[model samples]
Target: MRSYGNKLFLFYIILTGSVLAVLGFVLGQLFPFYIVNYFSENNIDLDTDQIDYIKKQFAFIITFLLVVSFILICLINGKLIRNLLDPIENITQTARELTKGNYRSRAFAVGPANIVELRNSVNLLARNLQEIEKIREIENERLKTLIENMGSALIMIDREATVSIVNRQFLDGFQLDLDEVKDKNFLTLGLPKRIEEFIDHVFLTELPYRKQIEIEVNQEIQYKQIYGAPVVGEHGRWLGVVIVMHDISELIRLEQIRKDFVANVSHELRTPITSIKGFSETLLDGAFKDEKMLISFLDIIHQESNRLQMLIEDLLELSRLEQHGFSVKIMPTSLQEVLIRAVELTSPRLDEKNMQFNVDIARDVTVAGDFNRLIQIFTNLITNAITYSPENTTITLRIKKNDEYGIVEVEDEGMGIDKSEIARVFERFYRVDKARSRNSGGTGLGLAIVKHIIEAHYGKIQVNSTVGKGTCMIVYIPLRKKRN
Candidate 1:
């Protein structure tokens, strides 16, 4: 027996059935008596005395039917009570779960049918919670991955300069341990004096500062620029500061490279362009008077034009190769044919350097690639060796075949690349000997072009060099494309 609803239901059933039963009884009494009295008074010899027994029997039947009707009403009242109470009980349970921060919990339908509004409200809340959690997870993962992989070191500190978070990359890059440094005062830690003072300044002012700090790592001094900003929380609360330490070693190197490239390009172009302009100007000024002078000027002009054209062509080729989605058709081509073309192109340079050429292209070393690009690649490498090597030095072009691939190599006993600069030799406009590179009439782009063209063919190019001894360039190329 539930308290309020059950008691109200019992009272309603009893009261409603009692009133209806009384009304039915009244009607049965008055109507039956009237009918019987009318019959008795109007009829003659109609057996009125026996009719009284009939009226009594009729009254008894009406009383029995009224009692049965009251019983049906009580049953219906009980059903209504149960239906109302069941829904209330379900809602109460759902509220209790919600209070426990079970945001995903939902209410169920109860009683005769589900209440649409209650179920919809609960469902809406759960859906909102699900969507919010999903978004939070995605955002958290994205940020975590970003921090873990970013090249710069990242650290977070409170306004009091207490470290809060230090990414693993930052920790390893700086040789720090979080367990050892956590909850420690930066000013008293083994940090450099300048950095400690900077931290103290930031904490006192609750502002940010960017400064250059130098640290020794692995016995080498490294330079970095550290930038900080105040981290604000809800209601303008000053939570902490976020610090980003950016390594500027590469940046500094690139800056120097840019300055050097400008000077080199200007100096190189000035001499040739000046020669071409001077010779043309002299010829225009009636220097054609001497047919010999005219011929000499024309020869110099042709050489200058060719040099300019070669440099421009190399620049354009590099630009084209760097573009994304660039593809080459890998077709079967004879290695001998490629070598012959490269030799034909470099015959002038080889003759100028007085170098001997020996080619041993395997008859069976047929490679699959863009034939024209491969020719350009080898032509550049051979020309470079011819330009760098001394007179009468033997340059070798060896081509061979394996079970899976073809190989081509250019070896020379030249003023070889330094071991340190060997790795960067293929970079754009890089020259191991800047002075010697200029004197040799190099545009400093030949090897870079070779590198890109080989890579585009899905081949690899490597260089082995010793500063005073010699150098070898190796190219590995696939014989055929594997089926995907």
Candidate 2:
């Protein structure tokens, strides 16, 4: 009871003061009465009735005076309490504001030493909160910037699945219309069932999730890897969920390309080598006994050997292009010479196909690059045109020069590349028509090698094709090396 009520400082002060004031009033009333009685005994003789009346009247007056003095004491006590309580009222108001998140609130310094100590403590607390708020603001900006530059898209939606926050990458990755997404529900806005299921699972289980889904959004199919984590607030309350979406299509494509390249490389080198091995073994056992037949087998073996040699040479050349210190010679050279040589190298191919070649060389069309590498670039393009085109379709090479660069384009009347396959044309072992590519003995390294060579000369290549209309491959090379 003492600690809860009596030991309370304000109550203790007010109570102690009231006790002292009452005692003083009682003594003051008694002392005067006692002095008046002493004077009456010494100075006057009174009859019994008169003496009784005087005593009664003195008792009444003392009683009335005591009442008046008590009232006065109470008034003074109240004024003193007001002096003690006014600082507390100010501190309470500030504390109320602090509880409302106004950490900058401060208390008045009018109270006693101990109460002043409390005020200082509160001020220090406010200062700390102000510092924390400043740090939080800076961190928020830094975090937002970090999220903007991150490759993955991040979005946070409340429990109702309304998007409350979306990082910059999230907006750009999906080409999202921000205004449309702000308050829309995933169900109403048309999200995939898999994504909805994932969100439901997260909410129900109160756990995180990760899954990859193939999304066909707006007629474009893409592989999206989604990871969702719970946003927990105070007391482990589930506030929202954060989703990070990553575009894994390129990585997936590269992995597939790597696997195919290994398989294709094995098939390409093994076929002719296997043929030579089989024929040589047969001849060694008994086929050589028939001499006339033996000569035909030897000729076939030589042809296979030459094919193996060619394959090995091309592989070595590609390796050289990839190695460090194997840079191109950037000097202005006649693109005509490079195109002519590329055509001459493919002459046997044209003759074998019995296909006519159309050459349109714009006068003074020039490029700056290594001559041999540039020749390889054009030759690969021309050879692909010849190999892929139908029997009677003509292959055309056109060169035109502008002020800055020369453009060499090869147009072939062939079964054009599928729109989906065009992006991966330069990737090794990517074939638009796999069956035709394999049957025609396309090594698949040709375009890959051409890509490296053209890039080495700081050139660009673009392909445009329609299904029935043949493909056009444009090569852009600088007329002079633009010095940096």
Candidate 3:
């Protein structure tokens, strides 16, 4: 490459040559005239040979000086040019490094004032660019993290309706691989028909769309709340769409439970209320005239009233246990003591049935729980066992403690629960055998209450049963250190 030094040297030589030519011309004219006049006045004459000799000497001296001056100028010009060009060269190198993604590269401050200024400006620009790049990287990472952990499925598409980005939630929830769907058109991606239609509408309208959609996945219906919006570019240009999918299946199920609870409560209240009203009416309509009939009717009314009271009390207790502010009175309580109290409360029924009791308990095992609530947990389980087991059947009660938990188990050799019905056993007012449960004086809320009590103490309850074999209920409550 032609350098600045060389170009400057060439220009200097040309200008110096022109100046020497003009000086030579002036000297030739003036010196000749002046010398001739002086020689004439002084009566001095010179031969042509001597004149030629003098002229040759003058030409040789001037040529030698010109060559030396040219050499000096070349040296000066090179240094000057280098001083000017070095900063520019460094700046260029820094630019190259920046283009290569090395933002840390910088130019040294050197050369003239102007060159230094230029270098500073270039460095400032690079610093600003670096800052911008850092900001962009941080924002990108934050966006990625939010999308992955949002617990909602999301997809992004390009203007061509090609799937360009899908987050981890979307991939896992839908069981898809990025390689299978990325860069492929939406219609060919095997998405649900409803989702495809949603995308199409959002793309066409370039507006936000929201809807609730149901799709069967693996033969199970899933409810989703989907939101679709157009991705707009600069100047409001259409840039495909983004779809956000939220699984609202749990919300839907809860709403159905609420409705069912209302219906079931109404049905339960109606039966008892009907009985109480009918029996009271019979008594008032002259059944009181006959002593035997009056006594029988009064007894019927009193029994119905008692059942209603029991149902109401159970419902109230359940409501209290389920309240959001339901906090148990937690303290160090003995598991053995709680079990003894529950057994004492259920002893009358045990004796009447002549059911054999098998107790295996470890003494002084302590757990953190509400004392009264723990008693209620075991009492409900024992009473449930008593009602289900036949006379003379053996009922087992076991208590033990591990490093983490105090475990209590109550098992009965009664007709075991159906496997399919086991999952719903703890539901409020849920009865596996409705007629038998009512006849045996069950409010159908007993197990539900027991579940809440155990959970309040951060414990777990599990049931194992076979159709012909007996049902076994096992409970675990977090163990605590013995009180001092």
Candidate 4:
């Protein structure tokens, strides 16, 4: 039951006692006899007074020797105990530091061989712990960076339905900050109720879930695909659920456009096809006997057939333009020549509408594009201006060059487009006045084709219009250097 300190003190006391006892026993047996023998051997005769003085001197000598021996033992034991305990004290301090998470601490390898070995082992353990801690920290940082930059919105909720983690993508996508979401409830973040329901279901069932969801943000409908999975810990313990969302708004929009295109094409073809079939059947049913009626019906049939052909050609051209492999033949060509050719082609409409052409083109201005596509672009613009403008109104074709591009503007004092519909003018099958466009022999794909052609040349086209004032279509094409 004695502590180490008490045991050490007791050992020191016992060793001192044993040394004194042994010295006392030897001195008791031999000291007096040696003194008598020395005096007898030397033949030195003494009186009673001389013997008494000698005995007193012997007692004094034994006492002084015992005192010196005790002092030496005490000094030596103190030095030995200090040497034994100092290294052990250093090792204990290091252990305490390690327990406090200071893995860099190390004990000094001093003292006896065995103690030195223990110190070295402790130091080795500390170094290993430090290395392991460093690696773990690096891995944790890498995981954090990966989650933040994963490009898909991600949210994690614990079993308590508390939002635990939201990455950078989730914050940016939802227009939220860390303070708004961290440690918040899953149902209270202004998220669609369906998302909250899905999270609750995941937590209750401890299973994965996936669905396509529609959400409205800023009054615009958006489609998203969500993937949810349960996060489980050791021994299948439910930890949390992780949800990832991918935006599919563009895909949904494209699908809608495709459906609309199919329906419009069908309707456009059906009208012409019905007219041609009816006229042909009538001609075979003795309507040919009346020459005047026969000629009128045949002409109508021919016009309808031509309109159908034009619609099909426009659709095919648009499909080609949108194909992945579609490419333009880019070569330096004269912008002036292209404009002149387009003007000549549209002169028939100009003559019919009695419109005046005001042409102003820069001399020798060149552009990089396919010649036929450039001609098509200008032809469509001029024809549209002629079709929409009142007779005798001037249509202006001004071509010029700036620092980096050749610019062309086809302007008209026509019944202009509305501001709200201006943005959608280049969309296929979009017409400002559908009935008027049909009667004027106009295909609604003209501006759409013009846009595709301009985009192929890496150029831009824009429209500016004020109702009842005028409309101006501006095209900017990259200028090409003249070859010597």
lDDT of 2: 0.80
C-alpha TM-score for every candidate: 0.52, 0.66, 0.66, 0.59
Model 1 error, position 84 (Å): 36
Local distance difference test, each candidate: 0.78, 0.80, 0.85, 0.87
Query: Which of 1 and 4 is ahead in TM-score?
Result: 4
Estimate, for each residue in 404-426, the C-alpha lDDT of model 2 and write its tens digit: 77999999998888877787898
lDDT of 4: 0.87
Candidate 4 off by > 4 Å: 1-119, 130-152, 159-163, 167-207, 235-238, 250-258, 288-295, 331-437, 440-484
Pairs that collide in candidate 3 are none
Evaluation by lDDT, superior candidate among 2 and 4: 4
- Over 234-264, each residue of candidate 1 has an lDDT whose tens digit, in order, gives 9999988777888886686678667876776
Tens-digit per-residue lDDT, 1-484, candidate 3: 1375577767877887787777766765566567667777999897778666766666676667767876787677767777777778888889889999888888995977888898999899889889988999999999989988889999999998899878988887777888977898878877778888888899888889999999876555789999999888899887789999999988987787688778878888888889889988887887788999888888877887888899899999998998998989999898889988998999999999999789987567888999999999999999999888888998899988788899998999998899777877898788887888888888888998999989999999999998777999999999986658
Off by over 4 Å in 2: 1-134, 187-193, 216-222, 289-292, 324-326, 359-368, 400-406, 432-441, 478-484
Cα RMSD of all models vs. native, in order, equals 12.6, 10.3, 7.5, 8.3
Candidate 3 displacement at residue 45 in angstroms: 32
Better of 1 and 2 by lDDT: 2
- Displacement of residue 346 (Cα, Å) in model 4 is 6.3
lDDT of 1 at 370: 86
Q: Which should have the higher TM-score, number 3 or number 4?
A: 3
lDDT for 135 in candidate 4 is: 98
10 residues in a row with least lDDT, candidate 3: 1-10
Candidate 4: Cα lDDT at 40 = 88
